[model samples]
Target: MRLLVAFTCLLAGCLAQKPQPCASPALLTGTFTVVTQNEKLEIYCKYEYDALGQRMRLQQQGTYQTKPFIQDFLLLFREGAMYQIFDTNRTCIKSALKDKFHPMEIPKDATLLGQAVLGSSSAPGQGLLVNTWTGDMSDKTGKYLSVVTEFGCIPVSTSYQTNDYGWEVIHFFNNVVGILDPSQLNPPDFCKDTVMKTDEEPLNFLSLFHNLP
Candidate 1:
């Protein structure tokens, strides 16, 4: 049969050699559970990177509910990390960064997910941030973007600027969502004076909350 179909296409091209990533320095922590229509979220992250990879610490913890509204947060990411934080409750909307829910400025179309390993997402609200994509909504406190694998794993797509809707960074989890791109995330410049985050902008853990009180 044509030499058994050319030896089954030469044994599937020598078993397709294309699965090689993860060398050393591994710490793309886990623990996630997300379900979105509006809310029902839980995330636990602990990322560590250095040796010239950037993204030293992106320790995030989130809790969300939408029965009567239960929101708990603690976010701190340095050097522009795509945001979309809300909870106006009509108090002049706190720090005010709204438009369609604002905080956009993390795209130079420089994929490799440099800062924290989040990239191209969807399945969060069924369509994922594409209302016309005007800015950023990559998730730091939104409730979607379960974990998009930027450093590596080849599952890219979280660049939806937003205009009307439909970019995608919703939510999904069962397992194996472990990616640590941005060239393996290496953050250690004493993490910019131990977790910056201050007066107006610039923040990143503050030396793990000043050694926790």
Candidate 2:
């Protein structure tokens, strides 16, 4: 009876442990919606991500501080440049891209909150199993909570709060495994006339809009 009880305890301990961290596919295409606290900024974007090549592209439309704008961004991590195209004005600005590629993955040190089914799980394969995790930002200035599919590690949503940005929630959807067109990562021909602003402050995705007039 003691041996049987010991075996049962061991099995329970194993089941209680959290799963290892997982990463989404290296190459993917997806759409995401971003909404900030106070409804001051909202953005809808279609993106192509190439982690292997260290490049990304985004075509986004958004209202920032109550002003609507359409823009396209090509981030070339290897070249350390970002081309921000103003779609309405047919102008582009080439600025230094100071950020590196950050994969969409649960950090190894993240704390697992729990797991839940996204839909009804009364029948087999009826619902997606997802896990929630919370962790401090890389800079340790903010906190984030994320939900991702259990099996595929696909990101479903994330909420981030920082001293500077306040609260922002991003919902990711329609993500697929690969980039359809390689050229989508390249700067458009109209960007040939891009004004170089490398001498100005370097920009990351979040900081890109602050410089916009």
Candidate 3:
């Protein structure tokens, strides 16, 4: 009877210590591209994020107005600040961004679209599930479908577009990883300071007005 009790206790302890399946909170450092043929725009983005996703550095290199250009976007979530450095104008834009670290999980109210087997076969269980969701009552235009991978990452997402004719964006991430230097997240001193309201930011409104021209 004592041996049996000991065995049961051992089993219980082992079960409690078993590791649970948790997705990586951050993406691997790599480059992704955003190509819009109708707009004649191709943006090459290289991104890096801290393990906790509290800080990120994004570099966009591409061509605009038939000339090559590059820009850097920095997010310091801990400080509630965002900075943008533009190579074309040698300017830096700083603004407050009210963002906080939230654990990644599919929304409880999201509508399940379908299951998808994304990523290479070599990376086992890199599959994702698709879901459609609408934003809070204040924002009706935020309706979209998002693909959530087993790693808790959204590799693809789309805003509302009827019959697929309006507009769409797709991203493909290169499988790469490396240690990021802290200096990469800082904007250069030469960048003249510029500040603007979040809603009035040009990048924030690019999608809304780009089709006009």
Best by TM-score: 2
User: Where does model 1 exceed 4 Å of error?
Assistant: 7-9, 14-18, 22-31, 34-84, 91-201, 205-213
Candidate 2 clash total?
Answer: 0
* CA lDDT of each prediction against the hidden true structure: 0.31, 0.85, 0.53
lDDT of 2 at 141: 78
User: Where is model 3 poorest over a 10-residue stretch in terms of lDDT?
Assistant: 204-213
Residue-wise lDDT of candidate 1 within 34-80, one digit each (tens)? Answer: 23233343334344333222234334455444222322222323334
- Candidate 1 whole-model C-alpha lDDT, 0 to 1: 0.31
Tens-digit lDDT track for model 3 on 1-213?
A: 999999999999975552222333454566666555354555777877665646767787776545676667777667666777776777777766665643333445555554445554566566444333333212344454545443344444434332323433546466344435656655567643455447653332133223222
RMSD per candidate (Å) reads 16.8, 4.2, 7.3
Ranking by TM-score: 2, 3, 1
lDDT of 3: 0.53
RMSD of 2: 4.2
Query: Candidate 2's C-alpha lDDT?
Result: 0.85
